[model samples]
Target: MSKTILITGVGKRVGFYLAQHLSKSGYQVIGTYRTPRPELQQLEALEVQLLQCDFYDIQQTEQLIAKIKANNSSLRGIIHNASDWLPDSDSACSISTIEKMIRIHASTPYALNLALAPLLQNNPLQFSDIIHITDYVVDKGSKKHAAYAASKAALQNLTLSFAAKYAPKIKVNSIAPAMLMFNPDDDDNYKTKALNKALIKQEGGEAEALRAVNYLLDSGYTTGQTLKIDGGRHLV
Candidate 1:
């Protein structure tokens, strides 16, 4: 039987692509999305089990954990890819903004890992994974997205802690990427400026992220480390 993997925030973007790729790669994918989108129908056709979850609500998160535990006796991996981009400059409640960011990016992953570690332990291959999808802003603080950056930083820090706690049982790691792809609505000036920040000078694409994820899953000795796929943005 193909091992099962759970991925959060698969409504679109990298998370969506990961779910699709991993499904085709022979893993049983169980994905979560906060909001319904047409793409989810495609995933369902591919045998990807979809769940609706809102990480901000603790009850909803708990219910998701319960559902996973009830359905699967074992899991091979989990990818925390669900995220929200909220600039502090936005006219929202300041405390709410920070809290929401932490809740989705940090709090949700923390809860899921603790609750799902047992399922991960039952992997037939004896190697399980928890991969956090972090952001490049984690290294360089963002003035406009301070809360978002800090939350991702916290998620990265969890990689170290969970790696130690799980030890020989499960491996915990992170992937930090910058501008994997641009939204269709982004203008030319915005794209040019964004591309200029990366040494690679292009959208890194979902393939880059897939490569990083595959490396971590296939490795025997990699844990507690982050694969930086930022196109060398830190060098700029």
Candidate 2:
């Protein structure tokens, strides 16, 4: 039987790419989305199962997990890629924004692990993994994105905590990425600045992010760690 993986916020961008890559690589993918996106519909047509659930809604989140449990006794892995990015504005830098960011980025994942822990532990197949998708800015903090940085930092901590508590069963890890996707319209100077921030001196791509995921999946001895896929951006 093919292994099954669940990826939250798989309606577009990096989430969509991950779902596509995993599906093509032979894993059965269960992708969740808040609203219907055409690209996600395309994914479903390509054989990916779509589950609509808002992670920000605690009750709905729990219900979604319950449904997953009823349908499958085991899950190979979970990629927590859904995040709510507050606008980079003065008003969005307030406590209210921090609260919302925490709810979506940190609190929701914590609650999810709590609700799914039992199911994960009971996995008759016994080889499940949890991968949190965090931003590289969490390492060096962003001036205009304080809340975003803090939320991802909390997520990193959650990854470590889960790994310690559920060791040797469900391996928990994270990927900290920097500029995995760049705007095509961005000018040369803008791209140059981004490149200069990394020791690798290059912008990252979707393929690099997918490779990071594969690394975590294939490494049996790795857990409780965050892999940086930022072209060495943390060095700067």
Candidate 3:
């Protein structure tokens, strides 16, 4: 395997953890972050290549593509973990809220995959991978987060198209997760309510997502499909 992976939105949460974990595991990890954060230094210590690009900006996204192309000859995988969660009800929300959400969740990934598809071809493992980190609300939709849900739904749809387009050379799939982790500011009551929505009834943590990503990377026949890591939330 090439052992080189690119991940986006690696400043915090799952993105940061994934980058750190993969880097420690001896992968050449290239990651992008919208902002500079202190925790990113941890990734630097692990020798992960870091880039700064705001997916909301088209020029920046284009520049990011150019940078990756100029620097790397080949890539083993690209994990589309960059995301934004803007609800329609927020005071900051406006008509462009949906546009911004789509740009981050759907448009940026669309552009990156199209541009980077060539680099993923001809891998030693016989295939490269593209994994979209989508959300559970993509199926049911959301009242307060209507725009957010719709954007994620669009991302999931892209998995089907890209999977068909890329075929045997590259596997395209998505991982839709629900309540995998809670924010640091979440209160006890809020945590309880969120945990109650899933049958597993516990915070699955970032390790759960790591497991899902590893499974797809190791699989030989799974593509154009979604591996849901939602702790059986739909059955509840």
Measured against the true structure, the TM-scores of the candidates, in listed sequence, are 0.98, 0.91, 0.97
Off by over 4 Å in 2: 88-93, 124-126
Query: Can you write out model 2's per-residue Cα lDDT over 1-236, one digit (the tens) per residue?
Result: 32888888898888999999999999899999998877876798779989999876788888998898788766788899998778556653487888888988898888778777766676656467899999888878888788889999999999999999988988999999888777769999898888888888766778898999999888889999999888876567
* Number of the candidate with higher TM-score, 1 or 3: 1
Estimate every model's Cα lDDT from 0 to 1: 0.94, 0.85, 0.92
- Considering lDDT, which of the candidate structures 2 and 3 is the better prediction for this target? 3
Over 4 Å off, model 1: 90-92
The root-mean-square deviation over C-alpha atoms between each candidate and the true structure, in angstroms, is 1.1, 2.0, 1.4
Error of 1 at 229 (Å): 0.3
| Model 3 lDDT at residue 202 | 92
lDDT of 2 at 97: 85
Query: Candidate 3 has which clashing residue pairs, if any?
Result: none
Candidate 3 local lDDT, 94-193, one digit each (tens) = 6699999999999999999999988898457688999999999998999988999999999999999999999988999999999988898999999988
lDDT of 2 at 104: 82
Kindly report which residue pairs in candidate 2 clash with one another. Answer: none
